[model samples]
Target: MPRIKSPALLVAESGADREGHGLRRSMGLFQLICFGVGAIVGTGIFVGLSDSVAQAGPAVVVSFVLAAITCVFTAFAFAELGGAIPVSGSSYSFAYAGLGETTAFLVGWCLLLEYGVSVSAVAVGWSQYVNELLDSLLGVQLPAALSASPGDGGAVNLPAVLVIAMAAALLVRGVRESARATAAMAVLKLAILVAFCAIGLSAFRDGNLMPFAPAGIAGIGAGTTAAFFSYIGFDAITTAGEEARNPRRDIPVAILVCIGVVTVLYCAVALAAIGAIGGDAVGGQPAALSYVVDEVTGSGVGGGIVAFGAVVAIASVVLAVMYGQSRILMSMSRDGLIPGVFEKVSPRTATPVAGTLIIAVVFAVPAAFSSLDAVVNLCTIGTLAVMAAVNVAVIALRRREPELPRTFRVPLYPVLPLLGVGCCLYLMYETGWTTWLQFAAFLAAGLLVYLGYGRRRSRLARVTPDADATDAVPQPV
Candidate 1:
């Protein structure tokens, strides 16, 4: 039997009518915004907040703002590329079009770690919250063997695995269905967060903020780096460029609006959490939100609600991240940078079913057994690297293709992109050397894939898109 090659290596003109690629152009600005929100407001807010507050005390609120500013810089660059290219691959396609094959492969490589592992990490976090909610609401709980990962002294996380599998099923069914599910969950999560803020604020103590810079400026910087992970999903808006109804106008709007919404939410949530619990308690205490709520409300109800909200929120994150990974794989497959099978679309559902399933399996395993913090750190590094690359791509495209039609352009050319690169690099450094080592290992794997298959097979390696060509119309649904 002949070995079946991966679909990611197939080179073909991508369009809605293409046999293997079935992503539809049915998403509009609202759906796009929902995607961003679903992806952005997950484990970072629910789980990572405790760590950030611990690192920076009440000053984590300021860290959230700083992280948002960093994201804004890259968001501008992404909006420009996403609008101009309007493709399914997100940063991967943009880098291919503007940079080159090697760089494109690297971008895809970075995204694999960023989205794949991030989904796993979010699923793991979801498991904890689900267990918390069950214990609180039903007076029952998943056994330790089923609720925690192996490293965390458990056999497997059944809840995490279940969530990943369910999300995969939804994605394999169709993008629209998945988006609807995500949007519903996002709404619930936001509502719960707002409720927490309103209630928690009533219990705020000014003294909780006395040692605002407990970790000092260094701690604040570290907090910002950690908090930056919370902002990763803001770029999910750009991932839907090809699906978006009006990429040029809506992608930018969605990105900006999502960032603004999430930033404000992060600040409010941090302020409330810190004010109610104090920075020391939030940082040192596990399941800080629940503890804070129990302390203030004089009942378990607040904690139960937040835990339930977290479960729902991280479910959406897992779905969105997996969705993004599959799409990127589809794009790579179409470009002949990976095996052709990954590009195969389900005739009935019109989705990259093979790719989606493959990634689902990959993510599910880790989600079942890995630690959330380890996965989160890994994702943060990959995301920061990609953001930095996008910043450079922005400058490169501007200088290289001065005449290309752009629906959205990053203002303050060079300056904003440069700042974006600088900020991402600073965060990358703050991610610590251990995470960097893991990132380096991931990058090495990507290099092996590129050298082994991607370099020789890449469509761009054979025929680069003409710099002046305007004939490549956006794919229709």
Candidate 2:
């Protein structure tokens, strides 16, 4: 029989307080919400809005709503599972408890694509805004060779790699400091976006919204596909399962609150940008938020402010997402799925120091050379796959451990979970054919690694009654 970890054991481990054995529980409800908001509002809002606008025109607002339906359905499942499991492994832990070991490994492998590549991609986006900010302020910016990726007509992207390294340094310093920075940056980001909307609406021309669907339903569908990935950020909150104070309560509420906050920001920003400058100008513009601000004010002051905001905002995404990625690997390491180095938490900092540096170097190299639009679809495909597994795990756990202590439950029972899975599949189908092939290669690579390394080394390989003994975990108050 395949090994399925017990949810009871998972919860027991999360609540354990052995010296130097677990992550520091420093985040509360507020920080968790800020982390989610910080992660979601980055590259997707600051950079990709133009491409989405080009696709859906003024109708991009509709696309945001359509895309949010997927997140709405998935959030309920995540909230429920996050409350019940509350492990640093996030969905991977949920799967390990609800599904078999092989399946859990696959879910984790897919997450590398989600959190890992997404941060690199966000870093690349940050480079564009960095130049915008510098040029607006000092009339100078880094050259293409230093700022642009090789695929984008440059030799290497130094800025991208540097940003990732900086984020790693902050993560290594400690999660508490990282959360504090994220919360502050989250407030700054919201303020800039709200300011952009207000300024843009002041210059709003009703005629700019003419021909709302230039590309028709097909265009709207394409835009919806682009917008859907923006919602992937909230799951970063789930990865904090080990570091959250009163996680069972805070984690679930954080997911819900993050989604609500992000959805409003996305729709409002998209609408405001399109309203001020018209879809034609907004479409295909890099440094779009800055561009929109410049057009409205006819001065660099507003543009510079928005650019500065984008710089800080995107860095926070890099910080929060990289933190989540490091934690995931650390959890996998504890299970003997990856190198033991990942499991080594520094007693001084209470953070996975070595694992974080490795992640930074591995991801930053690709950030120096990879194309922006190329791997985004790869990240989306990977994220959708993991979410589908999470929805399934929720159902599996309910049937297998009906009495498990859960602070929250998915309404409509299995129907909501099933819809969540369906939404994931539908969105996955929207990506290009290359994304499917790439995901297949990643899946196969994961299987080989598991069979050759993880399976033999996994702590569960020799599970015994005494080894697994732990008292039932009580639901958080």
Candidate 3:
């Protein structure tokens, strides 16, 4: 058998320019870390916490730890591959270079679900917080007609749609500008969370943790899986590899540092909310922290502050996740796996204008009328599948490219990657049958698209006969 050449080794020679796309190398470690933290911190901490606590009681803090562990394992793997490949579109680019065209297509398809659906979900959540803030602070409420989905007793989600549109506009302006905006939002949200923790902790009550694991191990496991959704965007750090000032060193640091900061924030907030409002109550309602603070303070100030924080946090998530989606589409287009129009960059802004517009429309429509739960569930399943793929890819790359330069490596190699795979799969099983079905349907749709259009147009499929003859080995499984 001839040796199969990994595309991972095919470095685009330094200074080799691709046409049409003029994205500059402008991101630094701080910006990359902010992107990851901004995207990861939002919906999870703001909206999903109540759901997780409802499932696991006060033990939801433990769920955070478990979820962080799972994320750390995957992050290490991502750091290694991201450093080595240093490309946009993250796992899509990694799979294309390490695996083959078919696997790469599948990964890209999964990423569409991860970034696109996640952004829409976050937008929906942002709308909820926006309404809450308005009602609490301004003595005005968005009319029901514009506050929620029709199915949820409202005609449309105006806030969600607006936020999605705003994010798209920001992305169209330029990557650096968008990154700066995300960083600012992230800082503001983090500060508010710290303030919440400080005030809530001062009023802590010990009795709230009486039945810490009330739903038992099964519930704890389910909560752990749900909590993992909050950690999805940390990999966004890896997606900026191509633009990072020093990807080999900065990418890994950004991922690990962001994860550390986020984990600490999550644990503190969970503790504060539970301590201040009795675990029972916090676990039983929407906007858990807000409700808890209101009860503890006998006033709405704390609740209003949390609601405001959530608005900013969820908005940041929408911007970051949508940015990730557009970049992935741009990468697939450049690889010839999708239509070339997506790869077209604006000469003025150096952004993928066409791709951004398409993503904006797709996200905005759903955000305008769909439930956040549905979109969040879909994103969780897709992200788990992609994380599993990255885990396997990491181990394969290690064995195949033993000499590859890695700025960061999973310390225990196969052990860590295998653990990451197991954790992601366990979470996938917990995401419920309905979500699994949707994921299966999405994969089937991707298969049809690949067969009907991608197969012929794929850059890999068009490899020259001479090149094929020289490297005529069965592609990696």
Q: Which candidate ranks first by TM-score, i.e. highest? A: 2
After superposition, the stretches of candidate 3 with alpha carbons farther than 4 Å from their true spots are: 1-21, 464-477
For each candidate, what TM-score against the reference? 0.93, 0.96, 0.94
As for lDDT, the candidate ahead, 2 or 3, is 2
Candidate 1, TM-score vs. the true structure? 0.93
Tell me the tens digit of each residue's lDDT in model 3 across 40-70: 9988888888889988889999999999998
Query: Rank by lDDT, descending?
Result: 2, 3, 1
lDDT of 1 at 43: 84
Candidate 1: lDDT over CA atoms?
A: 0.80
Worst 10 residues of 3 by lDDT: 9-18
Root-mean-square deviation per candidate: 4.5, 2.3, 3.3
lDDT of each: 0.80, 0.86, 0.81
Question: Mind giving the per-residue lDDT tens digits that candidate 1 earns over 1-477?
Answer: 111111121212554224334567778888888899998999888888988887888899889999999999999999897776666788887776556667778889988778877788788888878878887898888898988988999999989889989998999988889878988998899899899899889999999888879778998998998888888767667767556667768888888888989999999988998888788878866566777788899988878988888888998998888888887888888778899988888878878888888988888888888776656778888899899988887887777667666778899988999999999999999988998898888888889998899767865445533232222343222
Model 2 misplacement above 4 A: 14-20, 464-477
Residue 195 C-alpha lDDT in model 2: 94
lDDT of 2 by residue, 1-477 (tens): 667778777766544323345588899999999999988888888888998998999999988998887887888888998888788888788888777788999999999999888888899999999999999999999999888877799989988999899999999999999999999999999999999989988988888998999999989988998987777678889889888888889988999998888888889888789889899999999889899999899999899999999999899999989988888888788888888999888989999999999999999988999875777888898899888898998898899788878899999999988998998888788887888998899899999999999988887765642232222344333
